[model samples]
Target: MERSKTVRKGTAYWILGVFAIIWAVITLYPFIVTIFSSLKTNDEILGSMLNLPRDPVWHNYYVAITGAKTLHTIMNSIFLAVCSTAGVLLFGSMLAYVISRKKHKYNKIIFTIFLTGIVLPIYATLVPMMKMISKIDILQPNAFYTLILIYIAICLPEGLFIMAGYMRGISRELDEAAIIDGCNTPQLFFRILLPISKPALATSAIITFLACYNEMIFALLFITDKAKYTVSIGLLYFVGKKTTDMGPMFAAIILTTLPMLVFYMLFQEKIQSGLTAGAVKG
Candidate 1:
């Protein structure tokens, strides 16, 4: 009976392995097709989508970067991503720390308001957001600083929620100790809580940055300036006189996607470790 059970388990594992392989291939099909499509000419792509590039044209990458201004937009996106992420981390963490630790009647009300922003769709406020941006003389969405500020604002609620939860996991003893050692609230927060919350911060930062990085609607609607356009808005480079600019666009898409791929590759382990170690239990 033991031997028979062992054989059945082995057979089940093999069947599952086959299904997993098939699923992986299915998932990867579009990306694989895109890579090959980027290398092939339009005629070749039209002729046979499945065929390998017999003579790969590498200039598509160069053209997409240089001629299509993909590299510049990518640079624009990086700057925006970094600045917006920093703002979210610095401001969001501070807000969370105060709200989570401060025992006041208004604390719950404030936190509830912040959480409600999660369910508020950006589309609902599009017109008002535009009017508000226009109303602020120096705060045009086309301006990089203005755009980053908007990103930070939109990102704050979720970050605040995550950081607040994570902060609760840290003991109040540390705060008491810091206060006894002549530390102010700011100092205790900056010096003690900040270091302890690194994992939660990392998790929130990565998630927020990626969301802002890939966001399209705000980028498209707010920024009319071509030079200030992000990678999400850079897809217009693919549209030509009559049809889509397939070849160069494919290359651009891959180039646009590479940064995210590289970012995940570097920080995926950190994200996993951080979530396990830093997240709150209850």
Candidate 2:
């Protein structure tokens, strides 16, 4: 009976491993196709997308970098994403710490407000935001700064949600012990809580950065200056009125996607931990 049970478990494990491989193939199929497509000519891609390039056109990457100026747009995205993500993490974690630790009558109300923000669709605010930006001359000077602020505002709710949940799982005994050791609020927060919250912070940063990097509608509408285009807006340059440059476009996408892929790969473990955080009470 024991041997039979062990065989059953082994069979289940084999089935799960096979299913995982199949799922991974399904998930990576399009990305693999795009990478191959980037190396092929437009004609070759159209003829056989599933086939590997007969002779890889490395020049397509050159066209994407030089003609489309993809590197410039990537730099712009990095700046915006970094700045906005910093803002979201700083403010969100501070607010989360307070809401999670402190006792206040308005705590629930504030949490509710942030929860509502999570529920609200950012696209719905585009018109009103555009009108507001139009009226505010200070916001008009630098579109990047404006968009950074907008990204922070929109990302804060989700950041707070993640951070606050994680923070709540932390023991209040830490806070009390820190106070007993003569540490002030700021030190307790910065040195104690923040350090322990690495997984949550990494999780928040990844999500916030992705939102800022991939945001298109606001970037397109708010930023009229071609020089300030984000990666999402820059991709549109390949589409012309008379002709669409498919080869260069696919190359540009691959170039733009690499950084984000690397980032996720680096922090994937932390992100997983953060997602499962707050599940068990300590």
Best by TM-score: 1
Tens digits of lDDT, candidate 2, 1-282: 999988988989789999999999999999999999899887888889899988989999999889888998999999999999999999999999999999999999999898788777778998888899999889983478898888899889888888888899999999999999999999999999999998789888877787788888888888778788889889876556334557788899999998888977887776555445422211
lDDT score at residue 13, model 2, on the 0-100 scale? 78
Q: For residues 1-282, write the lDDT of model 1, one tens digit per residue.
A: 999988987989789999999999998998999999889788888888799998998877887888778888888888888889899999999988989887889888988888778777868878988898889888777888877888898888877878888998899988998899999988999989999999779877876777788877788888888888899889864556333546778899899889988987888897565445423421
Maximum-lDDT candidate: 2
Off by over 4 Å in 1: 1-11, 236-245, 270-282
Q: Residue 206 lDDT in model 1?
A: 77
Error of 1 at 51 (Å): 0.9
**Candidate 2 pairs with clashing backbones:** none
